[model samples]
Structure formats: C-alpha cells, structure tokens
Target: MTSAIPNRIRAYLGWCPMTGAAQHPAPDQPAGAKTGDLADSGGSVTGRADRFMHLTIAVVVLSYVVAILILPFLPEVIPVHWNLQGKADGFAASIPGAFGLPVIITLVTLLFILLPKFDSRYAGFALAKDIYAIILFATTGMLLVMEVIFLLIAAGYDLPVITIIPVLIGFLFIILGSLMPYIHRNTTMGIRLPWTMKSDDIWKKTHEHGGPLFMAGGILTVIGSLVSGIWAMALMLVIIIGVTIYISVWSYRYAKTAG
Candidate 1:
C-alpha cells in the first residue's frame, strides 16, 4: 500500500512514521547531552535567533541617529505644488532635518524590535533578519527622498524628483520583504494577513506563489518611472493595490480549505 512505503522511509530516516515526531535521547544519556537540545526544539531555538535580531536593530537605530544628526546642517526648505495639477508652486520649511520625521521612524522601528520580544506571533510579522537589509535599503531610500526634497526646495526647484524615485524604491523594498516569508519556513516579518496567520499551509502556499507576483509588480512600478505621464503613475498605483488585494483574498481562500 502507498502508506507502507512512507512508513519504511520514515523509519530509515529516524523519524516517527505516523506523526513526524523526532527521536529523543535515551534515559542513559548524560545530562550534558542536552547542550544542543535547545537548537533542536523549535521554541528554544527562537532565543538564539533573537541575538541576531538585536544586533540588526542596533545597526538600524545607529543609522537613524546618524541621519538625524546630519539633517540639521543641510537645507531647511522643500518645494511643493499647491494643487493636484502641480501648476501652483509653494515652499515648505524642512525643520531641523526631516522636521522630526526621522525621530518618528526610529520610534516605530524600536517598537517593531520590542514587539517580537513579547509577542512571538507579532514577531512573525516583524522584519526577518535576511530581509532586514532590504528594509534598511528602504530606509535609506526614504532618507534620500527627504534630503533631496530639502535640497530642491533650497534651490527653488518645484519638481517631484525626490518624491518619485524614493517612493518607487520603497515599494520595491516592501515587495522584496514580503517574498522572503513565503519562500522560507521562518516567518518573523512580512505582510501577514489574517488567513496566513490562521493556517500554516495556506500561508506557505499563498506566499510561495505571491512572492514572485509582487516582485514582478515592483519591477513594473520602477519601469513606470521611465515613462513621463500621470497615467503611468496611476497604472502603477492600480497594480500595487490590485496585487495586494489579490494575494490577501487568495491567502484567505487557501486557508479556508487547508484546515
């Protein structure tokens, strides 16, 4: 029978054939034998992972601090269009660098770091270590946008140059971050939907498929930058929103039956 083959294989692999249970050490084994036992247990292994998490957060916090310090010495103004048509011009003062925007971001980032220590489920939604680099990239892009806005304003340029590229890069960062959770077993940071949170299988399947779609969508958004028109921007927004909704719905349906 089909079941007999898998049972045999599981036995050969030293795993429980029926429930995928791991073989434990014998009673005769010394107490010290459990040194690496924590690594074997899913719950305990999480502690080791936290070390890396703390280190990453430290670096992120440092970057924000440096930006906050450097911002004040730079420009103090940014240009903006008064109307939707972007025809009327206006200037907005950049207060002490990003006008305390970096402070707000740093606070949010710290909150994200602390959230995982208390709530592992929320940690699942926190940015994963592997994806931390991308999140940082997004942060860097945002800084560029902020700095560029100040510089342009000081120069009296009313263009949306800083806004366009940074926003595009930020979008790519989210798309990239979202993909890692689906591609891997560990889930400590991503766009975790209610469905994905409820059923592991549906979460895995939906992410496995959704990751690539978001990546493609991100690439398209970047390309949208090349074309000079409002319609292109509108199209990009539509794609981003549409793709997000599609993945959310797909994840929900997949979870509904998986249980």
Candidate 2:
C-alpha cells in the first residue's frame, strides 16, 4: 500500500508513471508522446512550445547586447555591493562589472535552456515542460532586471537600491509561489526535502500549502520594503525562512502519518 501511494498521487496530478529504464525518451521520440503516431498528433503543440523557448532566448540575447552597448559610458569604478542601509560599499572596474555580469547571466540562461534536456530526471521534466518554461522565462527576466539595476547605478542614477531589492525579491517570490503547485516532483528543483522526495503525495500537499504561504510572505516582503533600515530586510527573511521551516516540518509529519 505504501509503495502504491506514489502512483495514486501521480495519477491525481495527471503525470505519467515512470517505468524504470524506459522512462527516458529515445533520441528521435517526440516529448510526452507515447509513440510515433501520437508524436505526429502532438507536433503542433510541441512546435508552438519550441517557438516560445526561442523567443525567450532572443530576449536574453537582446538584453545582453543592450548592456554591452552601454558599457563604455559607465564610470571607471562601479558600485557592486549594497548594505542593508541602501549605501554602496563595494566597487568594481566598469569594464569587468559591465561585461562579466551579463556574460554570467547569459550562461545561466543557457543552463536553464539545457536543464530540461540534460537533467537526470528529464522524463519528469518533460511531464511539466510548460511550467518549466514559464519558470525559466521568469528567472531569466529577473536576471535581466538585475543587470538593468546595475547599469542604472553605474550610469549615476539615484535609485533606492535597498528598497528596490526587497520589492524585486518579493515579486520573484510571488511568481515562484504562483507556479509552485504545478511543479512535478523532481530532484533538480522545488522543495526537495527527504520526506517530500520519498512521498509524492507529501510533495504535492506541501506545495499546495507552500504556494499560498509563499505568496503571503511575498506580500509581507513588499510591504516591508516600504520601510527603511534593516527592519524590512529582517522581516522579509523571517517570513521566508518561517515558511520554509513550516513546509518541511509539515511534509515530514504528513509523510510519516501516511506511511
């Protein structure tokens, strides 16, 4: 009965059951299709999804190009670090700061693109490819926002770094939270606690509970950002950390009871 639990949960979640070595698709197999016949039927859906992925890559490339074009006009030393008080405390040479960060963002975006194809649990990833794509796009957009923030500071804008950081983080949390429930259980992402990993039901339930909690926390964070000083940062951290602990404990207890 315990062993059968995962399959039941997978069924409830509308995910295909993994079949040992055959879970991974063949080199020529179309994703999420059972056979070539089904693949042909699903071709249009797959093609549309691929086009969205291509568009995301194009956006990343365009953002990088814009960053590079602005590089030469920045000051010799750029602000690279900020304190809780919103003051710049660390600096880096404009050339490396401008170029290197965008390079790193591009590499990270490439990794996100490759992850679904290369992860050990690619089969599970394929099951949730649409959600994965949305997550990837949101993360890449966040990185681009960070790049823009750096560029704005480098260009001598009097932006409120400390407040902006918290609000952006809150927005990111809200985005992730909104999508968390759709994320299938996989080793490469999501709340990967031992008990959650052991039980599919627990993973689903945890995310179901966690998703709302995260959104609430994110709201609190955004509200906190309106206040100056370390208090806002401290409150945001407490909310995030508190939710994490709550979900882990809840998942463990739920799993134990189910067992």
lDDT of each: 0.50, 0.67
Candidate No. with top lDDT: 2
TM-score of each predicted structure versus truth: 0.58, 0.77
lDDT of 2 by residue, 1-259 (tens): 9869976644333322122112323323433553222222223324424544665686678676867888877999998877766778988898877876668767877887666665665654555564555566667777777778878988988877777778878887887787677556666668878887776678778887888888888888998888745566666778789988887888888888988
- How far out, in Å, is residue 74 in model 1? 7.6
Candidate 1: list runs displaced more than 4 Å.
1-77, 80-91, 96-98, 122-127, 132-137, 157-163, 170-178, 181-188
Error of 1 at 217 (Å): 0.9
Residue-wise C-alpha lDDT for candidate 1, range 1-259, written one tens digit per residue: 9999966654333222123213222112332333234332222223324533554455456555555665555455644333333233765565543444455556656665564465444323321332443344445446545544544444565666523643465376445634343222223555567666665566667766777677777777666655635454555667688888888887777777676
**RMSD in Å for all candidates:** 12.7, 10.7
Residue 245, model 1, lDDT = 89
